[model samples]
Target: MKRTSLIIVSVLVLLSIALTACQPASTKVRVATDATFPPFETVDEATKELTGFDVELMNALAAKAGIEIEWVNIGFDPMLAGLSQCQYDVAIAAITITEDRKKDMLFSEPYINAGQIISVQKSNTEITGPESLAGKKVGAQLGTTGAIEAQKIEGVELKTYDSYDLAFLDLANGQIDAVIADYPTALGFIGQNSEKLTTVGEVFTDESYGIAVCNKNADLLKKINDGLAAIKADGTVQKLEMKWLAGQ
Candidate 1:
């Protein structure tokens, strides 16, 4: 009887090990985003739902990668910090890839090409671009590449805001001379306030936007890159550009 019991116990242990080994890893990911930038990511005022190019693109990629996602809308700076600390699985905004940032977090392959541009009041002629912003008040969203560029302008008074909308508002109200922001994002703002705002000069810095992943989440990065490659090859990215950026 003792020998028979030992054999049964050994069989159950082996079976348990096999079952555990056969189980698939969890693919549900927590995706963080800052939903304030338009054309890239924004919240719909009427529905209070997140919408924009990044949102749609992320959904497509998640579906292609066979992963489930839960959206977490957070401040852009906080999102970056959280990603570096491995607090979130992934983050997708119009986040420009940089070597300095690369030290903290992992990034997917370049998904979109973006650049910083200068936006000023439509009637303003004195301020032409970053060069002309010298000795002038310039506004940008806090913790963005735009703000970094603004800070580079010698003699320029740099003011950082929580969102581009507020910076543009300050520009419209004559509180600030100009705003530095991503070209497509600036276009979205200018399109809505055509009478009040317009971009000057040209895109200043060449930038590539990438999906941010936590340093510890290498598998997630691979999934994102695979999905991104598929979408780019299938014309999905071009379709999104037309849908959101062409008119703006």
Candidate 2:
């Protein structure tokens, strides 16, 4: 009996080693984002760590996909450039999906719907929407859909900023006449400075936000889409919306 027990223990140990050897190494994906956009992605002032809707959603997706991630907070345009070069495994920064962008990188299924809107000083009534912006100074974040929309309006003096917060600041200081930005992002700014700014007119352009992956990383793309689908089906997306954008 003792000899039989010893043989069984040896077999079990070898089987455990074989199983461990068969398992693949964990995948660690590098993710990029511009943390300046709030409610979607932002750095916590108190903890100095990244926080917000996109950050939380990505964390959930990473867990679901069984991958480790390294977050890279970078400028919006730089992030795009890096993503195109396959320098990062994934990016999620409230990036809007467009045909032009689709040419350069792979995009996961859109996760959020955000449209462009015009914002002006509280006392200003002259500017109503895109039509009223002719010959006016309009600010938009560089390399964003808002910038593209602002450029479509002929005769407008377009001022591009690295981030929307700066553009909104300039608007508040009377340096710019209007700011064209994603509706929820504009709402994030307006929520903080409600006394100084308000959005005018309806959302002019319909846009959807998506997670970006380099064309070479189809496997990662699948994981992201799969995780996104899971989150959507499990009500995680709705819960995030309620947490970050409920009253905005």
lDDT, candidate 2, equals 0.94
lDDT of 1 by residue, 1-248 (tens): 99999999999999999999999965999999999889889999999999999999999988888889999999999999998998898999899999999999999999889999999998899988777888999999999999999888899999999888899888889999999998998998888888989999989899999999999878889999999988888999999999999989
Each prediction's number of clashing residue pairs: 0, 0
Residue 33 lDDT, candidate 2, scale 0-100: 93
Error of 2 at 26 (Å): 2.1
Q: Pick the candidate with the highest lDDT.
A: 2
lDDT of 2 by residue, 1-248 (tens): 99999999999999999999999988899999999998889999999999999999999988888879999999999999999999998999999999988999999999999999999999999999899999999999999999999999998999999998899999999999999999999998888899999999999999999999998989989989999999999999999999998887
lDDT of each: 0.91, 0.94
